[model samples]
Target: MLASLLAGLGLGFSLIIAIGAQNLFVLRQGVRREHLVAVVAVCATSDAVLILLGVSGIGVVLQAVPWLLVVVRWAGAAFLLGYAVLAARRALSPSGQTLSVGTAASPPIPDAGGTALRTRTTLATTVLTCLALTWLNPHVYLDTVFLLGSVASTHGDGRWAFAVGACLASLVWFTALGFGARYLGRWLDTPRAWRILDALIAVVMVAIAVSLVLPH
Candidate 1:
């Protein structure tokens, strides 16, 4: 049981720590300090739910209906492409507001004239975007559900322990990532920095979308 749990923990981190759409989005939200708790909660909770499903043998059901994944793949691709376009636009033409990390609830967005503007990334929008990024990506299903499930099944009666470890991994990683990005934001205080970040995000989104649409 201990071995299985450790295995799950290791594998979970290995799979999740890579650069991906979900990670990138979380990083962006963290740096912006917009709905940080909500974004982290959504991502961690979603991963826990998916891991549970996979450990419960839902992967079998998923495999039986391969078309479901195909449908999801296309939908994911479309959403990713749309996000890429938006990111590209932000990179090309950024809003005049500059980031101001504050101790208050909602940080003030100060423009060149020092006027405070409401944050553009609202709670509802942030939650929805986080959800879409978590659920729409077919890779999440493949990694957390199918792959992790298959690995867990090998643990026999210890599978539940493995699932628990994997779930913990998701929670830890997201919490750390969501909170840790604020420190990174110090370097991204300038508009040029934001533009560069957005540009990179756009390129990554487009590449992932293209990979989804292309033949395996």
Candidate 2:
């Protein structure tokens, strides 16, 4: 049982550590110190729900729906491409706003003389963004649902235990990432730093989108 739990935990963390839009958004929010806790909660809860669905045989249902995967792949690819373009524009444009980090209890504000845009990192947006990011990309289902579920399903009566382990891993990882990013934000407080990060995120999103579309 311990081994199974460890295996599930390892797999879950390994899979989520990859560079993706969801992680990028979370990191950006952490740096901005804007509703980081809400972001982490949404991410963790969404993963738990997905992991549960996967363990409950929804993975098999998705596998049976071939066209659904195709549609989702295209949609996800488009979304990634669009996001990359937007990131690039932000990086290259001089009109980008600068961000400042604050404590978890207070909201971060824009630099002096800059207009503050209403922060949209509320609980509703967090949940919606997480759901779309996790579900709209069929790759997520492929990984968490199909791959992880297959492994867990093989564990006989221990499958549920493995699922629980996987869920817990997500909870820990997202919590750490969301909070840890705030600590790392100390060095990334400048506008130039943000531009660089945005540029890097653009590159990563474009690269991943291209990889998805290109022939394996």
Candidate 3:
């Protein structure tokens, strides 16, 4: 049991630690102090659902549906490409004003000047964004559910143990990442910092899309 748990933790961490759109979004939200809990919750829950499905033998059924994967692959590629273009546009666009970290020191507040209102908006946006990112990407399903499930299934009686371990790992990682990003956000308060982040995200997204579409 201990071995399985350790293995699951390793697997989960390995799969999620890579830089991706979802992680980038979560990090951004964390930095902005916008719905941090909601962002983490959505990410964690999505992982749970996918991990559960993968452990439950649904992966085999999905394997029989190659066309579905093909469609998803194209859709995911398009989404990534679109996001990349938007990022690049933001980078290139001229701005008359830039926000400085010193200026952002004011405590975050909603348009209504209430913490509650701000929190609500943050939560809603975070959940929705996570859902879209998780569900839209075909690679997520293939990697998390199908691939992981297939590997775990080979363990026979240990499959359940492995799944449990993976789930726990997911919970730990998202919590740490979501909250930890808060510290990083403090350092990235300058407009220049945001611009750099946006540009980097765009590059990463486009590169990943190209890799997916043109795999060797």
Q: What's the TM-score of every candidate structure?
A: 0.91, 0.85, 0.82
Tens-place lDDT per residue, model 1, 1-216, is 999899889999999998889999999988888789999999999999999999999999999999998998999999999999988987886452354243365557765687664355669888988888889899999999999999999999999999999998999999999999999977887777888998999999999999998999
Sort the predicted structures by lDDT, highest score first: 1, 2, 3
Q: Give me the overall lDDT of model 2.
A: 0.76
The predicted structure with the larger lDDT, 2 or 3, is 2
Model 3 bad stretches (over 4 Å): 96-123
| Candidate 3: tens digits of C-alpha lDDT, residues 29-75 | 77666777777888888888898899899988888987887777777
> Global lDDT of each model?
0.88, 0.76, 0.74
Identify the leading candidate in terms of TM-score: 1
Q: Which pairs, if any, clash in model 3?
A: none
If both were scored by lDDT, which would come out higher, candidate 1 or candidate 3?
A: 1
Pitting candidate 1 against candidate 2, the one with the higher TM-score is 1
Q: Which stretches in model 2 have alpha-carbon errors above 4 Å?
A: 99-127
RMSD of each: 3.5, 4.2, 5.0
- Which residue pairs does candidate 1 place in steric collision? none
lDDT for 75 in candidate 2 is 80
